[model samples]
Target: MPDPAYRPAAPGDGRRCPRCGHRVSRYNDARHCSPCAQALRREADSCPRVHESTWAEPEVQSAIAARDFGALCRLVRGHAQLRQEDLAELSGLSQAFLSMLEQGNRRLTNIDKIIDLVNGLGVPAQLAARMFGRPG
Candidate 1:
């Protein structure tokens, strides 16, 4: 593969992927082309941080095995790839509130709040049920 660091044939022609050297349109000025960037994102997403394997950690797994929803909530957030601030933006909750909820200092007793968390974290319905129980 060509060196991504190689500059465009002409100085203003376009840019190349720093990692793979693939060329992309010059207008965007992105470091890596879209494809390469997507590939890198996929690679990063596959890491253990937010991947399924995170649920297998001893503490998280124990919480699942014991059906301890509060612990599960905390564990899930702790293992999530997005920071608490980012998650708060996605869930429309305050960071302090999310932290309190995750730490069990504040309860997640509201159905709406539970739904927001589940949607924001992409947690499956079955898993949410484990934490909040079924809605009447």
Candidate 2:
């Protein structure tokens, strides 16, 4: 008898998604494949949503007032419960670009991209005006 904890590896174990019944070449941690998971993420992220609270914390307000772009990005994302990937999806920016901004590797000077970020993240109009000198 096969030992309960010593199940043998099947020929295609961990390489097929049970939900979609699609065979993949590599093993994935989730039952769904990469494309399936990304599709689901897109569907979920497509919903029009915004953070309901204002950036009122003293530290966050200080960061905004200082115009510390990296700190502001971190504060906004953390307060809104958004991951960098989610922010990228919402802001029409690449994860790499956002990471660069957060890491201070890239300067945040482009008004157009900043507007996109402000709109996508649903930043308060007054706060956006203060930060960017324009209400986006």
Cand. 1 TM to true fold: 0.47
Residues 34-103 of candidate 1: C-alpha lDDT, one tens digit per residue = 7887898898775433456665577875675555546765677677755777667667678898788677
Query: Residue 126's C-alpha lDDT in candidate 2?
Result: 67
Candidate number achieving the greatest TM-score relative to the actual structure: 2
Query: Count of backbone clashes for each model?
Result: 1, 0
lDDT of 2 by residue, 29-92 (tens): 4546678867877988776454666477666666666667677777778877778888787888
What ranges in model 2 sit over 4 Å off? Answer: 1-50, 134-136
**Cα lDDT, model 2, residue 39:** 85
User: Every model's Cα RMSD, please?
Assistant: 8.1, 11.7
